[model samples]
Target: MAITTFPMIEKCTSIDRENDIVVTDLDGTLLRGRNSFAYFALVAFDVDGVLRLLFLLLASPIAGILYYFISESAGIQVIVFATFVGMKVFDIESAARNVLPKFYSEDLHPESWRVFSSCGKTCVLTATPRIMVEPFLKDYLGTDIVLGTEIETYKGRATGFVRPPGVLVGKNKVDTLTSTFGDTQPDIGLGDRDTDIPFMTLCKEGYFVPSNLKVNAVSTKVLPKPIVFHDGRFIKKLTPLVSLLIILWIPLGFLLACVRLSVMSFLPIPLQYYAFLATGIRLIINGIPPLHIKKSKGLLFVCCHKTILDNIFLSVALDRPVPVVTYSTSRFLNIFSPIKTITLTRDRAFDASMIKKLLKQRDLTIFPEGTTSRGQFLLRFSSLFAEITNEIVPVAMETKMSMFHGTTTRGWKWMDPFFFLMNPRPTYEITFLNKLSYEFTCKSGKSSHEVANYVQKVIAETLSYECTTFTRKDKYMALDTIVKNP
Candidate 1:
């Protein structure tokens, strides 16, 4: 048996020359072992990109079936281009600029980089939209001959329709390469997947990257994993001792919650601290340190929602029992929980009055996102609370679990907390930001929506997560039917 590696180019060639064409696929061949569109969607954290990814995840099964009859390029075009519908070209370009450098620095394959930089007439032939690929290719990589899928735009916004030639997958890649190069085959071709075979055949030399080889060669700062939901399943491989520990912790947690609730009225702070210690959860604070502002009255804490256990973690980290304001529908959780909270119904007038009253007594916390999220992004903040208060504090929260997720969209309220405590050591980090200054708000014209969006952006930036306009309703609608037996 003999061992072999990819052909390595040592010297550079003039890319401007027409005869020196070197075509490469973008996703796995040029970058890491991932799709460029998927990587961009995760890193950019743009609302449209996230929603587009969701649409693709949902429609992939249908697209898979359609692949049998139609061209793979057409199927990919239908699934991917739909995300760009109505997205402004300027917005997409801006997002691309922000993420491309990080991608090139962190996710580019070392072997591919050696091949791409050595060739002068490099053409990126990919199924990813040209709108995303061109900016990176021209501005960052210094190669502009990209033959990617063209997205039709109307009035400077994406129409979500792929142009006539369709996606550059399979035979479409060869067709586009021939049309551009005109009977002259590429000098070299590099691809990772079987779909790239068509274009590879048109080259004098072709290299297929090994599947098992580690592709991404990041030399810069580590990027955060994109916030995507995965279904929760019971650990079938858990040791007997671990399983017994998890089972024992459930009843113990219920007993502790009851004890905390019993004394919460008279000894609220002590009870909260006690419950936190009993759970054995840890805190790993970062970004901004948790501080207890002396002025509790008339203060509004706008925080990102992650789990039902968020209040417990916040109370432990801040060393104070902060009252939380939640939706009326979620009031049932309060029946057993120890934290002090105010429940608000849909009535705008009544809710405002109640929140104002609560703020007058003590510091109040509101999850402006209005529901729990995966903690990788901040959902759209409802402006109702912003309009009611001038003194606002932004809080960014993240939860880490080793065994099981304590919080999920599908889990029932009663059992969610138990699932959280069952983990050997579930940790939470809470960062408290300075109060939103009145002077800054006044300069921005002091609109409630503006204030809400500003705070949302601050939290998103602090956590290195995406800020999105997607709401709780959007989350439930997208995920409700898809996830099963969580």
Candidate 2:
């Protein structure tokens, strides 16, 4: 009954489709090689899949070790069903409709569809849950019979348990099949793993799908590396030191900035000791290593904004208290903040006059992205800043955190800095590019918008991120709509 070779079917095979029943494994056989459970979690749950996968990985070892003491069937049932504990049936159905088509197009076996179409009665039987596979089978593939693990549900949510005849693996699979179709056997069975042999043995013919036929799961490829955290006891011990740094450096940094502004009123070099101290505090708390490629005065620094923390890190990386030009909405807030900034009104003439005054004092920094992002991509650069100066320095900035993200479309601007400080450990990386002068802009006849786009592209490429035309206003509007609907 065992057919080890994958027979090449150039056209429709000579098998009798009118009377014979076809049984196939969904995961490794009909679907290209991938973990069916993992794929289901990712396609259905999105970001939540990371946590689910991590939980499974961590729990699996413990479950395996406990198997020697407990029944192996119980351990498998507990481990497999735990993932669906709180999920709603309706949500799973909706997600299946959205994700299954893409999955099928990308990972379905090249020849399985033809075999499926020609079968008289086709059945998908796998260790995967019946609820998860039935929709795709009945709606898309036009198959009625699906024999798989059954998840117990209460009301609308999963009860984190499987019904009797749990996890169709090994002998349990044979028993379940025998109970369902007594005195009958499949005409053909296809499977990819040794575990599938039990049910496949009952078929008149069996085909072993090679492991190579399985495609790599794209979700696993793009999955982020797991975050390891300091032990709670160790974090507790460092809490006092962290508190001391925040309490001492914040006010000290502000006072130092004020003194530098007062000294700049009369002297040439603005005292940047406060900026250095603030950077030190940030480094100590977050343990971010600042790498400076270029540090020079009087160069305009164009950067991507992720959070208010970007200003502090850039000042440290550049080794200067760079005066920032910000949108006028946060003018009053900046007055009370530690950093020195010039708030720009929407009026072009007013902004031009302020920029002229600021440039005379020292190096100026502007976030042409205009709004804070999640550090995954760059927003469209406003051309207004590029027109202000010819000696432009493009600075690419990125921030990483294991726990919290300090980004908002509709939150108090002043609170963003506090969010960074509150995070247990946040890292910021800044890369300074070669200063873009008039020569770079001269190619497009010194078009400010073109120059701005050029700089934006440089930063986006350096950070390995995509560029978008989304703005601060668009972000807030989207957020507002989500809140209203949600």
Candidate 3:
């Protein structure tokens, strides 16, 4: 069956009607490796051809053992080589094709092409071999007139040598496109790789996709399509191996923490700081990717009054010294093991002075939400702490668990720990959203209540959590309950 051409839609068609947008190149410029039809073809499949090849690879030893005797009689070596190579290529190609359509839905392909074709005469300018990419162009991209390296073909076989235009690198790409298309300039051009920079410079707008980072960094405008792989995805299937790795991490991490603590107890004050830094590194190694912690630098984290161990996990997540902002509670004063840095209670003027001192020294971490809530809910902010002079590097941490093993339900006190020790289950993913900054309204002008609400909103937006202002009176029956029980 002939590959169906995708029709361009209205969304992709924009710019001066008088000018033209000539697209150059594939696999990064116009198409992303991940979200492209090619990417889908390679990844999204039930029984992938690669799997079949792998199965053959696994079975090869057994087959070799069985065929040892038969090998001497027949040309076994030649047969095996032919079979494996043929099967590997066939399966890989087939799997790629099967996965492609799922990524580029029937309607999306046409919509994209309509945007492409509508701009001007659309053409695929790529470094990939023409024969290799043509089928994809015909089926998924719906673009003809592909400018790519022509592979040498003797009859049906691909010869080792490539014909003229041997190298499609750098200026070669631009010269080839300009020479063919002539003086009529393309209005818009897109490429993912640096090689397309020359080609992009020729066009009115050149869109370049950066390394694993989408939203082209180049000064030239980028097309919104194929920036990031956004299919209508609900559930991400984790392979058994990945699930196993996640499960194995719990015990491994616990043991490392214990060991690190033991070593730190005997170390000097300076070494203790190093130990704190090492803790952050350990977290990164153990599967918890860093959130807002850049360069593994130390941070002063101001967190909500939730569980006592939020800092511990946050520290683990950051893999750095997260100086937690804490109240001058007597219980915390006595317990110094977990306390990285302390902010002693002082007069409002003194508190401001102390905050300034802390800010100048290290990276800070803070949870604008004053109180913790039931796992399902978020509490309002108490921004008495947020009246700092520096920009508040805010973090919204959303903790999700398939099973509520380590979670606290309603009526739980602040001291009550959640996500402590539990049997291994489906993974609990803690995501730290982007850091935000807040402008301090005024020394006396910004009401504490207003600051609290603003902080709450920032946290809610970042973490996609529903934030509610819950006072201590509304939540707890008595203040004594926190001191006595918590």
Candidate 4:
């Protein structure tokens, strides 16, 4: 194949990419952007709340003027200051690792990515903070090297200052590229703006990616690793305007959530469904239990956790409160006063005795996943549910929120229900799968783990979710390093 040299990336014909070294700019080059302010706003809001977000928005005007006229580095410095000053290093790192990937993956530039991803050794040179962009670039895009402006830190907190040599822009990017690759020039370079041209010239072949709104981004499925898990409070990217709207909505949203919770707490189970719709909540239920439900004295309803309110809604669906088994705490979170609670302290023998006693008298529920997930994927199930009962029914639960997420690893766990209800229209869909047949039950001579995995697979297939070996302990340990040796 022959290569056709063209001024813009749109005119490129072909290239032998297997052995070529590629260097690229981010933001406008590798991703679509008005600029990186939206990402900054997202990080600020997620890590520190609306006050931090407002600071960044207020500073944007000054930054914009400096960027267009005075200096790009100066403008970015202001953004770095407003968003990161006085914040813990771990919080920013956590947001970068967990929150930014989904948004960044959605904005990939089609033309730039096709050429950038095909090369042997790929490097991304950007003005965005290295800590902020490295995880997405390495994990999702498979970049080999990342060179970006380095932030200054003191006592494990951001000082809102950059290290000496300052932001990587103009000539700094060229210098960084040469230092990393040494004497051998890169085979190709891709960039989107005039500032990027300095670094692009260092490569043998350079392509310009002009701003193109008509082009669609590549699908997330094409990434090197599928993003199975992510954490954040906001449901969408927080632009300056969007951030403002959220701040204004919170007071009214809080009042509305209180009304919704009150309805669930005081109203009859039959009337709760109608009352939810009247107050802007949407509940979609599917699949009644097998007819064998009539004979149920000890039905074990197992599900992947979605929220604290899950059992409350499960109770509503069953027309009575269901005591939920929890390992974390003894408290059962239910709106109805009649709802009962069972706390398992992770002692197999004691919990087994307690659970066996209840099964003889009534039907109860268990979140075999052990922790709440966003519902796009099912975490590994605990085999204890399978071992404890022969009467297990898998239930699939999913929630959709327009404004805020109801679950978080960092924020207040108790406030999850309030945050969920605060959404403009919060929706939950509950699907009950068929009961485990005698052949698949533990009573049928299968191992407990085998039975649990089967239940996970069934619920995952029903919800169109990918099943993972990750558990609640793995989740906390990954994010917070809370469980050091787990």
Candidate 5:
């Protein structure tokens, strides 16, 4: 005596008397690996099915290739028909049971995800022999009906001849299913192979699995969004793969040896030195930050204040014709110094006029924060250069795996680059968040103050940092009062 049980529980729903017939296909839809499993079953049953199929083709090369393509493309029809003709009915229950683990798993199989509550009356309508498939039906699939090929048996011994349900291909599949369940219909239909096409067509809407397959079993193909797997790491498709690859490869030994001496040679010169050096300097920065320029036109980069080396690294990373918008004294300092002519004037009264000229002539880089924090808290940003007409791209920079604000300006001299030289190797991570519109269109009809807060909040969120806002009164409040007169 054998037993029957459904693996998952089903939700009970009384079928409306009007429309209760739910017909679906089995092979590629309900049955995950029907073709390969059926082939395995035939091999297990006849033991020479593989050799016989091969010998048949070896006897006739053309017929063998045709058979291969037929088996590959329309697996359900060829395997079922071939199995029925190959051997007498034997107990395929064990063979079918053995194949269950391959088809279903907690991982790849989608059956567990979509089955929902299994209280409803269900059945599996397949073209496979009933005995060879009943195990999957009893174990993995809880569907009530199993309408497949009928195998002959005498005293539970082997008899090769099989009787298939009348014309079990295509539309006849819908008829078989309807005959099994009568007027009761199911809520969902699924199929994968081309032979299951007619069976799926019986349903209102059905989805094909592994949708890229040429011969889809269902009309509408439903598939998960593609995720990228690179070197055993999963990433979203939109994430920048090339930039990440460059970052990871920069710390390699061989590549470092080749370009290290060349890298050290440019250290004595100001970052602006490499900036104007042009050709080779351009290639180095291109490897660091790959830019996606639109129309080959230059754009402005708004950044945070870190150090003088900050502007240099920006110039090198950007590689484009961007002139840093610094103060008049800084511009004067760079004029006699090794700095290029791209630095802008920071005269307060003429700030608006100068910005218009910079946008018209060249791409501008401005540190909107105006002052530097110890790499910890983001300070209130000055709205001075925020009104630039050119595109404003906010660039957030932080060192990877470094102590918070490694050396503060209070302890280290602001003018000297000694701290940078003395410190051990620093791996700086610079991430360029997407470009914002040049025009500051206030969202939700926000006022200037609200807009400023929003911009500050947006930048803070983008960099994964916190910021403190100080009003004019807050700054004026005696530092001695907060310090307790000590």
Candidate 6:
């Protein structure tokens, strides 16, 4: 059958909001990418580590040749095999839920979104696996259905192979669409490349998305909600070259981490800043100058936690060693920590009494959020700090690492500080706000929870972050729900 060429995607305006059924391709049409290698690298690293990412990088040349020179299906299969093979099914789905949406929500194509978002009934057809792209499409994009390639899994792991209709490219996509929709053809179809062309032809109307590099990403305000939390150790978008650099630099990075920790252990507080500067670690301190506070009960510094090093960076800002009450850090971290650390047992009364006693000796720091947050967000604050002392200083912290993040809930906790120090020039910004008013204090007849929420709000506003009631337990619960429900 001979068919005529359709108009370009720019013509796909005036979409019906009530009843139009739009079937759009994923990678290039919906997302601004010629391929999905970056996303594959993300899943690879998120699931295993740099070693798994290195494995995928080593195989990309093979995948590239198969995809560009030969069949797209064969190319996608090779890439899929490298990324998914031997990985636990639970891990893949977990990344799909927690990690992928944040990236996917950022990569939406403007023109495709203009048409795709208008329709009430929408379907995303992609060569990527269904489990991977489905959560983002259905939950974030409001798609009614998502048809993607099925990965073959055995027992509880991916077998690195696609199920029967294989890699959903070219003719396979058309067949799948036909099987799913039958005689009732979709009203609008959007696609990018030649493979997408086949499936687009099956729709009543087809539109082409050209490879244009000038297109800007749609504003993030269009999203249902901002990404408050995300999982992964990567500090930047992973490319093949970046992955190679990480694999090559791990040995030196590890050694660097050790040297930094060693210096922090013995170096005097004032000289530590210069020492860090010499080692290519940056600590950017802004806001008002630190006030001199001498009290029997030391000043309580409240913070929204970003990483394990929050207390360390907070002390750096004040140019003095401050004792901290920790939550889930290993004994190794506590033993070798430069300053004092007292582990909390989560017992409200016992922990409160411990912190109160510790504060009386000298200046003490506390991260009331309990756990670290990866983005510009503050978890619910524990109010015990407010009740202890009215002399409180709220500190807002932001960390930028080009290589690796310092915090992880799923991996080894002790290695977190090491990963943070291993970066080429990790940047930390500390913003100190004025001390809290006595009127908002527990001594003013206000409840402890009220003080906690007030402090959380001040820090959130200072950082321009939205407040979430989610605590550390809420984070783990969300991750657990992914495996159980998926």
Q: Which window of ten consecutive residues has the lowest lDDT sum in model 2?
A: 226-235
Give me the displacement of residue 243 in model 5, in angstroms: 38
The reply for model 5, stretches above 4 Å from the true place, is 1-298, 328-349, 400-415, 438-452, 471-486
* Candidate 5 displacement at residue 226 in angstroms: 45
Query: Compared with the true structure, what per-residue lDDT tens digits does model 6 show for residues 1-486?
Result: 212266888887754556889998888888877668888999998888888898899899999999889988898999999999999998999888777887888778898888888887899888999989987888778789999999999999999999989988889999999999999899888887777778887888899887554688777788766656676677676778877888889999999888888777778877888888888889998784545642224678888888777777777767877777766555555666677777788787888788777777887778888777777677889887877788788888888888888876665667788899899888889898888888988989999999999999998998898788998778777655422110
- Looking at model 1, residue 240 earns an lDDT score of 31
The lDDT for every candidate, in the order shown, is 0.65, 0.60, 0.45, 0.84, 0.43, 0.81
The candidate with the higher TM-score, 1 or 3, is 1
Writing each residue's lDDT as its tens digit, candidate 5 over 1-486 gives: 111111111222323413333334444444343334323332342233234434322333342354467443244434444444444343244334432322222122244224411325455565556666565555444545667766555666445444444335556677776776566555555555555666555555444543222332221123221111001011111112322332344345224322432343344443444433432222122223444642234466667665444555565455433456664224222532333434344565577677777577666677666544443446677666554443556677654322112222212233223233222243344556566653453333434454445566666776677766743223223111121110
lDDT ranking, best first: 4, 6, 1, 2, 3, 5
Q: Model 4, 263-316: lDDT tens per residue?
A: 887887778888988999988889975556634679999987888888878777
For model 6 the local lDDT of residue 65 reads 96
* Candidate 4, residue 434: how far the Cα is off, in Å: 2.3
**Candidate 1 weakest ten by summed lDDT:** 1-10
How do the residues 1-486 of candidate 2 rate in per-residue lDDT, one tens digit apiece? 233543433333635686778888877677766344444433323323335545555555565665446664566565655557777776555444433434443466655555665788888887777776775567656775888888888999877788887877768778887887799888777777666788888988777766555344333222122111000101111122333443344455455434433432333223333443443322222222233323444567788987765665566555445778877435333554445877677797779777866777677888887767663567788888766777687888877654334553333345455444444444667777776765677443778878888899989988898777776656545333222200
**Clash count list over all predictions:** 2, 1, 30, 0, 24, 0
Mind sharing the TM-score for model 5? 0.35
lDDT of 1 by residue, 1-486 (tens): 111233433232334445466788887777765434344333223434224545545555565566557666656665555556677887676555443443454566666766676675778898888877776676557675988988888999888788877878878888899999997778888877778877787888777654323644844432223313322323222233433454455566556545433443345564555555565656665544434474356788788987776776676556677778877434435565556777677788899899988878888888888877763677899988777778788888887776555655543555566666555666688888888887546345778788888899999998899888888777766443333222
Best by TM-score: 6
What is the TM-score of each predicted model, taking all chains together? 0.51, 0.47, 0.35, 0.92, 0.35, 0.93
Task: Show the colliding residue pairs in model 2.
Answer: 33-214
